[model samples]
Target: MASDVHRRIFDVVARIPAGRVATYGQVARLAGLGGQARLVGYALHMADRPLPWHRVINARGEISSRGDSFSETLQYRLLAAEGLVFDEQGRIPLDRFRWDGEEAPAGPAGEGS
Candidate 1:
């Protein structure tokens, strides 16, 4: 079974809307796991659920490259499908897509209800 911290991270990740993204630090704070950004990354790495792992980036507004270009490319594609646009330098514009900690609407569409 997953620990409470892992569960909390998953919960926070699940709340991130499709078209929006949150940094690992942002997710840690929202999960009440403050300052545990790396922990959040570890949890998502092991999570078997459909959590929006692609929606969680690093504080630099860029995907944390796992030394694998394929996964990096996949993340970019997933976010692009959600309407997120990254800069030519592979940096996402956090100002445009960052989640504001507002509650995600209770639906599959990810719109505020």
Candidate 2:
């Protein structure tokens, strides 16, 4: 069974929209598990659901190396399909594509008015 922390991580990742990306640290912080970047990555690595996992990158706006050997290229292709443009050095332009962690306006209990 997925731990609570992992579930939190997945929830945060699931909210990342197309054409935007969140860094590992960003997802960890957003999930209320501050500084647990590695935990976010591990949760994503094990996720079986179809998440926008490709939208999670490193703080440097780049994909982190993976031992699986296929993820890097696949991630790049996935992001590319979303119209995200990478620099010549293969890094997403964080200022352009990075997900700004903004919450929409809400009413009581954090629900939309």
Candidate 3:
């Protein structure tokens, strides 16, 4: 079975749609993992290479790389290519583009709120 942390992280990451972003803390809360925001970061750090690590960012919408310039640059490039606009400071505008994970309605707008 997948470890609780792994499952939580994966579930959160899966919910994040393309062209949007979610903070690690937001992911932790959505995953029902209490306030273990750092745990989400740790899990992502240990994730497989194929995982979309670049899609997750700090609460301020800044890339989390403290070193490894290549990885950081790659993250920026990938996000930019996905239509995610970044400021001159290299931070994404979270409020304007945050992904709330709400899917489109299956029918007309009158069917649901």
- Per-candidate Cα lDDT values, in order, are 0.89, 0.86, 0.79
Candidate 2 lDDT, tens digit per residue, 1-113?
78888888888888776778999999999999998899898898788677879989999999899866688889989999989999988899999988877643465787622
Among the numbered candidates, top TM-score falls to 1
Which pairs of residues have clashing backbones in candidate 2? none
Instruction: Give model 3's TM-score versus the native structure.
Output: 0.82
Q: Itemize residue pairs with steric clashes in candidate 1.
A: none
- What are the models' TM-scores? 0.90, 0.86, 0.82
lDDT of 3 by residue, 1-113 (tens): 56877887887787676678888888888888868878888887777635667778999889997589998999889888889999999899999878885752444644411
Task: Find the 10 residues in a row with the least total lDDT in model 1.
Answer: 104-113
TM-score, cand. 1 vs. native? 0.90
Measured with C-alpha atoms, the lDDT of residue 56 in candidate 2 is: 96
For every model in order, what is the number of clashing pairs?
Answer: 0, 0, 0
